[model samples]
Target: MKDHHQHELDSRYRRAALPPLGALRCFEAAARLGSFTQAARELHLTHGAVSRAVRSIEDALAVELFERRSQRVFLTAAGERLRDAAGAAFDVLAAAVRELREPPGAPALVLSCEPTLLMRWLIPRLPGFHARHPGIALRLVAGGGPVEFDGVDLAIRRDDFDWGRRVHAQRLFEERVGPVCSAGYRQQHLQGQGRGARWDDGAALLHSATRPGAWADWSRAARRRLPAGQNQSFEHFYFSLQAAVAGVGVAIGPWQLVRDDIDAGVLVAPMGFLADGSAYHLLSPRPIQAGSVGAQLLAWLCEQA
Candidate 1:
């Protein structure tokens, strides 16, 4: 049971191959540019190729599409009708592709990332991303766990879990972690052995409630037992790192999160860095194909990492 509109669309699709896309493109360029020679130059084709393509379209439609004059061309009645229709059709096609390649909300590319990664890593690097991709409007949302594919187009997370086929995953880099504290805090609180201080030297332990065992895991890697010291816990890693940055306590810091601070001398990695075998991964909805804005972003992230 086909409706009239459905039948018409079906017939259009069935007969779409008549003139062929190549011939239509050539015709459009020739019509718009006013010369087959100019159209060939714009298309990087031989002038004869453009002429043949135009002739092919006219032959297929059984109608002349141009009026040849002394070293000039004009659109015939049929040619004028086709030029308008083809121009409109190509415009619609181009718009559809632009909409599909970009994130659903026109210019904005919605991103979901772990709060710590967003605050400490991604946000800092966003200026370069903007410079490289001025057309991609980035909208960042902070949270962690399985990517909510509802409205978000991409996510950055540090996890080893499977995201399934609906999501495309690319490993950016492995996570290295260690204890970090403000340089001023170390100078004020730790007396002498600030050069290679032990965690047992009475610095407060800033714990992330989300990852309570971070200290213990780091301890195992460094092969040192952390003393049971004054404990302060924060609900999230971002807060815990902030507490450390504020000189309140030592926080188990992922290398990427604390790298800039450490390099800038704001934070000191007392125990250096250790790899815990985890990685930061870029996740995007699988519906986004290669060469799209999301895919381009993933490539940029990998390069930056």
Candidate 2:
């Protein structure tokens, strides 16, 4: 009798009035990105397929969800309402999927961090964390900007942008930035330059595509004007820093990221580091319980900083 009752409940759920999951997914993506073309790219579906999926949803609901004007898409009133509902639903589903994929009996904390920090700083210190807390498994994903703590337990980011007020944040350390170069390059090109000397126009200026304004920001904070020089851009901040270490050029280096290099004589900060009015922060969705693995990791990080 219990089995029969359970089977009936499942059948009822199957017969519920709901749009096709695929259509809902397509509609949600289109609404969120405000571009069917971009949504198609994200979903790896053809643009026409995405359009048709959205059209099917509109037909079923009998409402236009988007307004098309000047080759741009804008969400209509109905779209905004549906977007909020669909986005929330997707977030819940995604979190569930992540939980389901984890190995049984092995609890893990997922930490999202900025790419350069992960590469240059956190990774080198992870051995210490593992040695201290062997029972807790740590998973790291590289990211920046506003963190979506769906599957992430913690995120480390510099306070360069607003990450909204929903999450609890703790200050890690103040950011200090300065121009750094390989020791060889400093000796050859900047041997006679004294502290806070004007930047030379002969040396190449290394730029990161990720942080194009880093040099400018440092210049502004140091109250000095940067003279024009040969510019070389790298795809990532870490790459630019590495280029600086390889004697390619001088790059704006965050003190934390280049501290070991400077201490080891691999790099030199002729101008020294200056506060850029930003600080690194550890962010989480909720206050971490004291003595928990997350809290342990947080405390360790604070000690390291």
Candidate 3:
């Protein structure tokens, strides 16, 4: 990398035994404005200083590069060529200096999200975010727990716990949930069942150990009797949702988490959606300032919700 950068600098800055940078600046300004006095004013140098710099450049190149008239100066044929080359060189140098002086990009966002939400919802939307804000990097950590705000910039989570005063919460969307199953499972087991059919009579119940009562709450809201059979349990909600998507069983999933799957026909909501009072929120230790990458990401999340 160092070799490549050096090569770039060499190609840009070295094409001839050029005059000093200050002399080149004086030459270009004097040639462009067609007057040594105006170039001196522009460069904050005296007219004699500009004349000496131009004479020095001409001596270095061994060419009479400018035509001097009474109180006026203009580029000769050789001087015009030098002026063009010098202007192009200065443009590249100015760009390099600008890049060096520009403030470093916003620090990469350290975000924490629930594993299930990260996998099912947030991951799918990341490509869009990256496309929009390519300068902003993201580091995602997964878990739904008491978040430590020291290293993390944002956390996407369901609002079910007491987050302390240091953490600020912004509601993204209310958590609406329903039972979802693979398309194949629904076709094989539920297609022939009429509207009054007992869908849960023999179907397997996929449970998340993290949210043990999700199935019960969904069943109560859907007004369906809980299946009596022993069901499979996963260590996390993501695993349960994966099992459901793989046609293992019916899993109670939040609408936001499973909406894409349903729309893509990977998972079908055999039962309809239910709006529970719970909500999803974007949480941070402190409020994000306007025009920051974190603020843009938060706004995008709210739009997605």
Top-TM-score structure, candidate number: 2
By TM-score, how accurate is candidate 3? 0.62
**Candidate 2: residue 271 Cα off by (Å):** 1.3
Give RMSD to native, each candidate: 22.7, 16.1, 23.6
Give model 1's TM-score versus the native structure: 0.61
Q: What ranges in model 3 sit over 4 Å off?
A: 1-104, 191-197
Question: Once superposed on the true structure, which residue ranges of model 2 sit more than 4 Å away at CA?
Answer: 1-106, 191-193
Q: Over the stretch 1-305, how does candidate 1's per-residue lDDT look in tens digits?
A: 99999999999998875688888999999998899999999999999999999999888878889988997888775776577557656754664465467655555677888876776677678779878986777777776888867898788887757677777777889999888899877766555464456655577989988888998998887887676679899887767876787688989998888899898886898668889989988887775578988888988888877
Q: Lowest summed lDDT over 10 consecutive residues: which window, candidate 1?
A: 191-200
lDDT of 1: 0.80
Ordering by TM-score: 2, 3, 1
Measured by lDDT, the strongest candidate is 2
Report the C-alpha lDDT of model 2 over 146-223, residue by residue, as the tens digit.
998988889999888888888899889999999999877876666345654765677889999889999888887888
